[model samples]
Target chain A: MRLRFRQSLDDLKEKLLVMAGMAEQAIQRAIEAYRVRDTSICDLVDRGELAINRLEREIDQMALDLLAMEQPMAIDLRFILAVIKINADLERVGDAARSISDRVRELQAFPVADLPIDIPRMASLAGSMVRKALQAFIEADAQTAETVLSMDDSVDKLNGAAHYTLLTLMKKEPNLTPQALNALMISRSLERVADHATNISEDVIFWVRGADVRHKMGEKPATEKTGTRS
Target chain B: MRLRFRQSLDDLKEKLLVMAGMAEQAIQRAIEAYRVRDTSICDLVDRGELAINRLEREIDQMALDLLAMEQPMAIDLRFILAVIKINADLERVGDAARSISDRVRELQAFPVADLPIDIPRMASLAGSMVRKALQAFIEADAQTAETVLSMDDSVDKLNGAAHYTLLTLMKKEPNLTPQALNALMISRSLERVADHATNISEDVIFWVRGADVRHKMGEKPATEKTGTRS
Candidate 1:
């Protein structure tokens, strides 16, 4: 029974890694769809979303079964719990990709505006954050996860800059409201992707260090609730 | 030992109920702040967020300790797992409240517009959804939880209508872009509050029936993975 449980744990990790790959690819494709204004890439993202959703359910079931049968304790329990939360974050990343694709589809109707927003750059940064966070999870690397936390600030600044730029473009050329809105929405989606990546990294930190570092930044000092061991 | 375990479970339920009250009140005050355009109410929401965050850590620690010490099985284990998820959702609902206040702060800078969007009405509906969902959770009434699911559609429709109206207003009055954007963001925040409520309801359903109804809405049919008993 113990050997079987070990095998199941290994299978769970492998499934999560595959799901992460799909989520990362979907975000890349969604961004490419936005860059080149290709509707076909949007279709691909939609298909990827379906696969991600299916994998999410399967992974969740596997984790729950492990808990039920093995009654995993200590680090094993924490790992399973973290996987559940990371699974949710990855699924939300997929949703972000689909949302970006939806905006791309809307953008297809309008002539591409030469707005001063560097959305491709923002998308690239957010995509790399996702990759790094997932890498941290697979390797249980707290240092990589910590770096992802700092990278989130860059994405936020870029998102704010894009927002201001898009608003200015709308005011300067009121006729471009629809196009500007679509661009603004795409930037917002990328920011959301970045936020999910931050969430994943935080989960990795918690899984590795057993410390809840969430809601700690921009606040006074750290008053962390240390994860107690049994 | 068995009696102590039962008491711990009861304590967990009570703490969650208190936490739910905090989340619901924060949503209500946030909506009221938007309706009255009161920064003071926003401050109250900010304070509520702090308390909610603190309680989240405490409750999570309590739940984790219960899981580690008791190693609960079957329905008891399911209940603890559900509490962890619901606790996370309530914390996110607090975040939605904070985001709404952030928009209100931005809106304070601009003149109020008598736009066609009924944000107060939508906020009221969303607040009620939170209340109903929490009540369902406390009562363990999946029927009430099911009602919360249908209510989500109404909130979604209102959010869509608000988005279109805000965009039209922005185009018609270029000067109103900032104010319109703030209002649009508040509407989106309220919509998120409603989504969190829906998530809580779905969790209640899962806890009661051991069925995962998530991502099952538009699928062929529900293929629930039964909660296997040990």
Candidate 2:
């Protein structure tokens, strides 16, 4: 029974990794859609959302079942609990991806304005944050998760810069407001993706070290939480 | 042991209600800060976040301890699981509140332009959604949870209209870009609160009806997810 339960925990982790992959891919594809101005990839991201949502439900159920059926030790308990929370965060990451694709599609209709924001660069940071957080989880390395936490400052800085640039662009060229507005929203979405990654890393820290570093990760990414970055 | 476990469940529920109250109060206070343009009230919202975050950790830890130590019945297990998810959602509602307060503080510095969006109306709706969803959790009434689900559509529409009005305002008055951009972010944050409320109701439904009505919640509030409501 103990061996079977161990296998079950392993299965749960494997499922989460799958969900994480789908979420990362969605973010990447959505950004690719923006880079190339392709609506077809937006459709793919939309479909990808359905799969991610389905996997989310499945993984959540598996985690709950593990807790109900198996008597896990403290460390194992924390691991399972972390899996549940991380599952939700990953699903939100998928939501962020879908929001980005939606923005990408909207900007497609308007002639692409050369907004002074590097969204793909911001997105890449958020994506790597997700990847590193998951790696921290798989390796059970609190230090690795700590690295993910520190990396969030860079993403938050990028988001702040993007927010300032886009707002300035809107003020200067009112005609570009539509595209700039969408771009701002996309930056916000990527910022949210990074926030989810930060949350995941916090959960990993909790699971591996039994130490909670939430809100302590940094002042809630002032730009992400509060509206006044200016 | 069974009686002890029952008491633990009751304890968990009561603690959640307290956390729920903190989150609900935070949302209302944040909106009031915006309504009155009071920066001091924003300080309250910020401090309130710390309390909410602390409660979240406490409740999550209690749920985990219960699961590890007690042999909860199927229904009881589901109840604990729902509480865990709801705790996370309520924390996010607090986050939305903090975001609103931040925007309010930012907006206060600018000349109050009578933006056409009805933010208080939308916030009241979102707050009531949180209230009703918690009521459903208390009563174990899936129908009450269902009402919260329907209420999300209205909030989503309000968010959509606000998005449109704000974007148009930005286009017409380039000078108002700063205020309008902040307003737009505020509306998005409230929209997220509604989304969080929607998620809590879905968790309540899962608890009471053993249903998974997620993604199936009226097409993911197109505006909240896909961003093409223009």
lDDT of 2 at B150: 94
Q: Tens digits of per-residue lDDT for model 1 on B1-230?
A: 66877898999999998988899888889888888899999999999999999998788667666766645655666677778778878888898899888888888888988878888899889989988998998888999999999999999899888888888888889888888877887887788889888988977887877533423424542223223223
Q: What lDDT does each candidate get?
A: 0.82, 0.86
Model 1, runs deviating above 4 Å: A211-230, B211-230
For residue A153, give model 1's deviation from the true position in Å: 0.9
TM-scores for all predictions:
0.88, 0.91
Candidate 2 per-residue lDDT over residues A1-230, each given as its tens digit: 67877998999999999999999999999999989999999999999999999999899778767766645665777888899999999999999999999988888778878878898899899999999999999998989999999999998899888888888889989999999999889999998999999999989987876534223425542122121211
DockQ agreement of candidate 1 with the native complex: 0.31
TM-score of chain A of 1: 0.90
Worst 10 residues of 2 chain B by lDDT: B221-230
Top candidate (TM-score): 2
